[model samples]
Target: MSETNKDDRAALLAEAAGPATELPPGWLEVVSMDMDAQGVARKSDGKVVFIDGALPTEWVSANTHRKKNNWEAASLMAIHRESAQRVRPGCPHFGLHSGACGGCKMQHLHVGAQVAVKQRVLEDNLWHLGKVKAETILRPIEGPAWGYRYRARLSVRYVPKKGEVLVGFHERKSRYIADMQTCKILPPHVDAMLMPLRALIGGLQARDTCPQIELACGDTVTALVLRHLEPLSEGDLARLRAFAAEHGVQWWLQPKGPDTVHLLDADGAEQLAYGLPDFGITMPFKPTDFTQVNSHINRVLVTRALRLLDAGKAERVIDWFCGLGNFTLPIATQAREVLGIEGSEALVARSRENYEKNQAQRPVQQALAATSFVARNLFEMTPEMLVADGVADKWLVDPPREGAFALSKALADLHQARLGAEGAPPLPAGAAHWVPPQRIVYVSCNPATLARDAGLLVHQAGYRCVAAGVVNMFPHTAHVESMAVFERA
Candidate 1:
């Protein structure tokens, strides 16, 4: 854990789980990286082993821990030959214990090496999960390495004996909060405010009452949503308001779950807003609204996506999983028309609101004439629903961790049927002449889903993954964020 009593950490761990495992003689060679960023190897007894805190291209001796029939897991014991890419981590707290802040992984690897590993992870997943190969590999998109996180949810816990309250991310491999003074991933301002936040929390009698603080920073506002397990007392309310005023921060309160998140001082004229200045669109959202944390890379990504898609005046486009119109509103400024589809009705309404807000101030003659949004159950989507939504000339999909498997499959069926000469074409008049969107841009948060959906798009849908690349949205951790471009055959 990040916070250690230092008296008996090893002893406590031993008491809890008794010396996880023993290291076998003869060092095993690490062949590859598994789903959890662990190095994979095997022992002579046919037991596969995974070593935590180990990377690819490096051979390390490890202590075996968890075991299964096909695979056994291990922790790094000794490095026989370390990769040249290994570098000192930027954050001091980045290791098994003192450095263990469950927030980031792969920090020990060089930044360039990190990107390369992410690309490899994406390629491996696509080939293994989807059995599809990209015709071209686009250069990985990159951005600032530090102070990029604009969305965060910090865990709050109090320790009366120490007369302190810890506020930061969770501990490595555990639910406890990491005792950290600052976070490198957060925006510069938020990172600077960490210790002050801890102090604020420590001062409150309701220190234990408040369990979380969700953060979202926009161009105009930095909203803090406090998640409290119990109701805040008048004293706690005053303390929070004082903290907010002192820090120039907007405060929100959640007495219970997410549904209870509300502005604590709304009349103070606070609105959280993120913007795509290139598209001349500013997106206003509640702190709870789902948006990518890395704004610098998001800008790069959207620009790259539009360039690859080549959305233009002659074509209309659809933005699937268009949460809060992040990509939809931007795409609208380039394409002739745009249809944004989302999973939540509230988000759909927000998208429409954002569209109108941007349209009124649209630059250069309102590049796109009209744009709209609809809420649909994308995972359970059917061909009929695809037809109902109106198939556009091109597609831009930015799904959640769950990729667009159902929608891609449904589109494939409709496209094939339309070409089969006996089935009805999807959407619009002169259905027979309707051709499926010629190109599709898929933005994915999870490589597995991307690979699975790519399989359906390539093998089942008569499309080929023309180009795919990785984007390190969350730089520290093993989580891989990627994008792929598919073209119809």
Candidate 2:
């Protein structure tokens, strides 16, 4: 009776308990941080482990959550030795703990250390990926550590069981939304609206149908785009209007795709704009349109790029991938005739409009009439097109994540074609003649792509990497924005 019953009971208990949870092997000292801001540690058996919420030079116990052939992804269980660079996180929702917000990483690391790590990341990418090194590293561009995020896409979900609506970023490593009360990275006013926004959504008849709220903050006004899957009733519209009025915010409703977004109260909405007070330029942009998330860093970055380009009043310059004339308009203030080029015709038109608006407000003294925007598919650039653009003393290239590979290659090809095998006939005059800019300033968001482009500019295009450095555009996050300067050898 005892042996048979005991065996049966043990089997039942084991079945109820499900699979046994495997404990982590042991605590390890964090050696360094990876590109994603995860601490890197090697297990005793030689397998590398990535521990989230752990810093370099810190000893931490971690549980392996995911296993791979070369490395394992782990969650920080306990920090036995903390780094001096560690600090109290600004946002309570930040960390690898349960129900933590995934909005920001590196918040626990000191701001200075974050920038230093980013600089190392940039340099490492340049050397390892492209085998190129800058002659000098420019000083890192730093800005406000908090409340610098002017753009954010906040998720919204209605939980019936909880009888509340959640409005914030997604939970760390989970699809579910984080129950955030306030966001430190967002502007103060927008951060304060989180709870109220949740309440407003909770009161809506189509509360569950509303999925997201996008925030775009300008110099004067903040715009919130609410994505509603179902049709909003009159009552819902009224409530939104009231919220807009009370909070002094503009409300945009997206019925389906981003293209369908429209202002709820157009007349009452204030124009969304940002000012580069240094350049005396103001840029008006749509809420959905791509704009720099940090205005402070952008202003500084633009100033630095222009400084590196070193455009003179009598020198002509070209700005590639110019959006809303952020760099082009400012460059126009210095150069003789600045041409702004973009891939999108709509963006080119918007750049022209922004130029006109700024010009009308404060007349551009140098080359006001010569400052123009042209639409071209920069990604499909050719050597012929490069030669046709005419000679410019300086160039400003700010490409997306894809980088300016085609443009870089075009420059290299144009340089080769002009030489003509040492003894070829002279080229025709005018735009057909290959003339490259003496100086070029490149603004980039992806370090790997930037490195690749830089390699071309240095080895193929006959440009020397004069200087490069990191830009802290998105602080408390792993995003690396940088600028580099090049001069024809």
Candidate 3:
């Protein structure tokens, strides 16, 4: 073929294979939103596109940058259609701009509507993935939608080209840090200190050495664990001390993993702590403690779990997967006897210390004196262990992401042996029938595990999923925190 003929054909093929370099101005009708909050719309050539920063029912001009088989990803060039529900985000850092904060995705949607969307996400995932449905829905537990986050791990980065240091969350759709002065999701105290953090990190001698900051807020104290890549200089250590004292924050340094974390303040007095004032209990741990991020939701969840347990002077209770005595101490208050079991020996030890702390302060220690804790492989807990532990009348199951599938199944098997008419394996051959709790309140971070565990409780353990509901524990993200009540059928 002639060179000119080949060139013409290649040019034509490239034009057909790639998206048009220029898009004609036209109003794009919006449809539904994707998981990332992008609005789905069609282009001038009838190709569907996902438009960022566009809400449902809103028309916009989208510039396509990437094309997919069924849809193209675009950035909103202009909004031609607006929805009545769309309102200006109160936070200036919100949007799809180059350096916008990625902490919040539903900032454009109203808080009420956010709850509805989360509910829909939860219910849909349950039906689609688990083929299960709850007969009753508990009222969506809601809390302060703004500045409620008490836990966060903020990223830190330094760029020579930008000639600046950034200390915050990553920017939307990018790896660079968000050039943000404040965060709307942080509690007022921490949110107001964003600029101070920037200035503080800038002042530290280990400014570049520090790569992250972990924030943990208890009822009265705010702790920050500076994740340092290099050992801090004496001068840097002093600076951290001053910053902690000046800002009323606790500071810890991590040169390695969590075990290397240590307090930097004078007298080493600054320790991460959370208090359950209702239980008159206090827990002291490192900033790396896996406490709930939303304090309000956790408080409510604990109260509900205890209420469902119905612990009283005569009733015994077991708090499985107890962390820092969150529910164990509270259950100890009402139960005749409470046994809190945990897998992490460190967590179990902390729980025991917390119970001791509770006992030392309260006169009721001598009066109640019913709670004790044990560290065991709860993930592998069997009917023998359950019976050996002396199963209580009520149980609170709070497992991690893997969920308590084995433990739940064992509980079901124990119930079968205890209530079996006769000759039913005789309690694992010589082992007594494992103690079977009358009711179980299961708290789960993963819905699939919860659904699976709930199925076992209902079908095998003779309990019914009486109530289930979602908790917006980690707001503005897809993580669904839910609780379920299982009553004997």
TM-score of each: 0.90, 0.90, 0.82
List model 2 lDDT by residue over 1-489, tens digit each.
133332332333334333322335577878767667888776655566678889988988998987765567788989988899999999999987789998888999999999999998798778756788999999999999999999999999999889999999999769999999999999899889999999999999999899999999999989999999999999999999999889999999999987799999887467899998888888999999889999889989988888888788899999999978899998877888999999988789899899888888874453353698899999999776776787888899999999999999888766665667454334444536457899999999999899999988887778999899999999999899998899999
For 1-489, candidate 3 gives per-residue lDDT tens digits of: 233433332333334343433434677777555445666565545466667788777767878897554456788898766876687786898888777988787678777666666666556445544455767887877788788899999998766686667878887878878988888889998988888888878887778788999999977778888899987888987877787778898887788988888777647465567776666666676678778889888888887777767777888888889988888888887888888888888888888787786687778444444678888888797877777776478889899988898888787787777778354434765446444677788888877678777777776777877777888886665467888888777
Model 2, position 326, has a per-residue lDDT of 90
- Candidate 2 regions with alpha-carbon error over 4 angstroms: 1-25, 44-46, 364-369, 418-432
Which residue pairs overlap in candidate 2's backbone? none
Report the poorest 10 consecutive residues by lDDT, candidate 2.
Answer: 1-10
Off by over 4 Å in 3: 1-84, 266-271, 365-368, 413-427, 430-432
Q: Could you tell me how far off, in angstroms, the CA of residue 273 lies in candidate 3 after the best superposition?
A: 3.0
TM-score of 2: 0.90
Better of 2 and 3 by lDDT: 2
Candidate that beats the other on TM-score, 2 or 3, i.e. the better one: 2
* Residue pairs whose backbone atoms clash in candidate 3: none
TM-score ranking, high to low: 2, 1, 3
Provide the overall lDDT of each model, using Cα atoms, as 2-decimal numbers: 0.80, 0.85, 0.75
